[model samples]
Target: MKRPNIVWISTHDINPDLGCYSGVWPGAEYAVTPHLDRLADDGARFDAAFASAPVCAPARSAIMTGCFPTAIGTMHMRTKAVPPPEVRLLPEYFRAAGYYTTNNVFTDFQVEIPPTVFDDCSPDAHWRNRPDADQPFFAAFHGMATHESQLYLGEEAFAAATAHVPAGARHDPAAAPVPPYYPDTAVFRDAIARYADLIAEMDHWVGGILAELEEDGLAEDTIVVFWSDHGRGMPRAKRWACEAGLREPLIVRWPGRIAPGTVVTDLVHTMDLAPTMLAAAGLPMPSHMHGVPLFDAEGTLAQAPNQYTYAGRDRMDEAEDTSRTVRDPRFRYIRNYHPDRSAMQHTQYPDHLATWSELRRLHSEEAKELAQGLRPDLLTPLQRSLVAASRPAEELYDLAADPHETRNLAGDPGHAADLARLRQTLQTWQGRYGDLGLRPEAEILEGWRPGGRAHTTAPPAVVRSPEGLAADCPTLGSSIAWTTDPPAEEQREPSPLERTAGIPVADGRRWHLYTGPVRADASAAWFRAFRLGFEPSPEVAVNIAQGVDDAQ
Candidate 1:
């Protein structure tokens, strides 16, 4: 049997707010997501999928490697720690197995984007761009229309984000559902309505992509996967490691291999994606990956499915804090390491949102009401917890009883066993994973960058071989990317993490992932190499013209 081709569509900072998940989430019914609904109808929709982290960089890093972010020292956003030599990326294994891998442009994985992970890592990459029609390909597409910044980055950003939604199709602000964490205000309702528009735009884009696939007559030969990096980009949902933040949409369409309309309620983590895809493609899962495979030819998951999903939060943008959470199907337990710190800390990015400003305004009003000994119903019980000066050391919520996490059951003696079990689970996970977030940031940085300067990967050597030319790097675990074509005057796009990252990200469009040998007479050949988590080597030019050779 032939291995199925894989195509992953990842959306940023979104939740399962599609029309198909009907009663799962309250506001899901309001979304006009015909394309996503059709996808679920054609395949399986996971009812209990969870992200490894509440934020994008950490969660995406975990998904890419199949290892927990904490285990590999990538738990913090824009983490500067380098991975141990043995912790190889998952896509390299795919490429080794003769699969063409491509990433459609988003590579903010906290670590440097390794040079050999994908055959294509630019905005123009797609499954259709594969060289051979028969080769199995793993393609990834990214959508950022629903990102948190889009909602507040001026009216122009909002207009571009929601361009697909017609004026008549816009949702009514009054009809939007309100989460218990926020006070019922017009500002929030309006934001939610606009959020629906963003989802509509995403759905339209997906439709176009699917249409292209069908037009190519490759729909049946491919396995389609659609998922979000995390939950809704709102105050308590996006940054907090709560149920609202961790829960995300997951849909898979594998013809003949998976039954249509299968709704799975297993407690599966998003990290499982790496192992699952590798396993489905008949490849061995690496020993370092912490995720479990959720696929087999029999169309059933492994006998021992996950009973719980775990997540943590560390250094979100400007906020410095530590917290961890573990959840069974019906219960969630959160341990706030920084118990003295307020739940709402000063973060310059999210503070600009209208909803954030409005929530602060109402929180201040409630504080005044409390000082006057006047008990007012302005803030709900759960909403008050978000703006509290300090957080409880431990929190336990029976999600079945209080889905909104309105009440804390940690102090209750009746559920002692549940609390003890979850607490121990969280403890065991932390001990086993060896969370790097516990260490001081300065210490980690010093270890990665000795003398305040990064250690660069050794430049690759271009040698004339029987085949023509082969480039090899001397550094251990380093990957080399080279091109035989002459260099073009392409402008390099800058990355915010470029200067600080352990490995400088290489963003070359024409370079190919170096394998054995290439047929090149050494003329017009250019080479660049990078190790797992260190600075990329400077580009090397070989066999250039006379004037350029003198400069070299």
Candidate 2:
């Protein structure tokens, strides 16, 4: 059987608000995503897809590695944690299986992806750039047009954009429906409308990519999978484990394989996509991957419906908290390890939005109202609890009865048995995954630090050896690499400096990889060093002026 080419198009902070999910959201009729709607019409639409982690880096890490972020020590947001060397990433497996893998620009994965994972991984990386026309390819395109920051363009710009809104594409903020927890203020409504506009923009980009596939005549042979990194970029959505945060829109278009307009209601996690793609390519799933393949070789659903899907939240931006959630079809359970912390923790990113400011202002006013011997009905009990100094350790909600998850049933005697069952399930999952959430934040940070500070490779000290210039990092076991040109900054675009031949030292090797010292005739050289789980060292230049004996 031939392996189908795969194109994974992922977007940021979007949930299943598309027309095909149900109906166009009120006031978001202008979010006419005809292309995505058409794709859903022609392929499989997963209604219960969720992200394993709420934040970008951790969720992306889970998706790329097919393992829970916690299992790989990548659960914390933006904290660089290197997985054990033995763990292989999804693209690496696909590449090993003869697939030309490329990641178009953004790789916000929490861990460093070794160079071997991709054939090309630059801003211009694409399946169209593959050297061989017949080679099976795996490409990922990440769209950021719908990111939360785009909604922060200020009121004047938003009004101008809304006024000029393309013909029938004008979303009225006054008619937008706000979340139950949020006050129906102009700021909140405008934010929702702007978000819808961005989603429409993101859809346009998706259409262009699909058109390219058709133009290349690779549409039929390629499997197109579209999804978002997590949920909508709102206060309670992006970093929380509510359905708004964890649930995502997933559409798979595998022409001639998956029947048109098929809807799968089975629970699926984002991490599962990695293993599913591997299975589609006829490769075995590695044992290290925690995700299960959803489809068999025949392009039919092979797995039984999952009883529950899990999601987690930890250390988003400057806020530090640990929360775990378990969601079944009917019930959603949340366990907050840091119950003393308010749900409205000071996260710098979300605080930039007008809606966030409105929420804070409303909370303050509600507090004042209560002090004056009167309670304002503007805030719901759940909303009040969110801004409180402490929170319930455990919360249980029945989605069938209260879809908004406003009521907590954890303490209800009638739901005690249901709560216990879900609680046990969450605990078992935590144990199975070796959840690092239970560990103290300081301990986790200390583990990533070397010599009582954050682990950063120091530049190798260049000394005038008897032979010539010798470079070595005294920090023991640091991997050293040196070249005539400087290395690229870590996590940025690959520099032309990378094209030059360089010496590399293997991890755990005490000595530098270069066996012999540089000769006097050599030009000035640049050197750097890095260890797994740590930041790379600053570039150090060794000038071989005049002769080796006179080198500074």
TM-score of each: 0.91, 0.82
- Model 1, which residues run further than 4 Å from truth? 153-160, 297-300, 370-373, 461-474, 486-509, 521-527, 538-552
* Residue 15 CA displacement from its true place in model 1, Å: 1.8
Model 2 over residues 1-552: C-alpha lDDT tens digits? Answer: 999999999999988878778642222244668889999999999988999988788898889888888777788777667565446557766776778888876776765544446666766789988878999999999877777887888667655533424756756788676777667788888888888887777777899999999999999999999999898888778888777788888999998889999988888998899889988888888777888888866688855547789988988877889999998888999999889998778777787677778778888898788899896766677666656788889999997788667788999999999999999999999888788877886677676674567567677777777787787776553555555543444444444323211112113211123434656444766566655455677866777774334323
Clashes of each: 1, 0
* lDDT of model 1 at position 536: 83
Report every candidate's CA lDDT: 0.82, 0.77
RMSD of 1: 3.3
The TM-score obtained by model 1 is 0.91
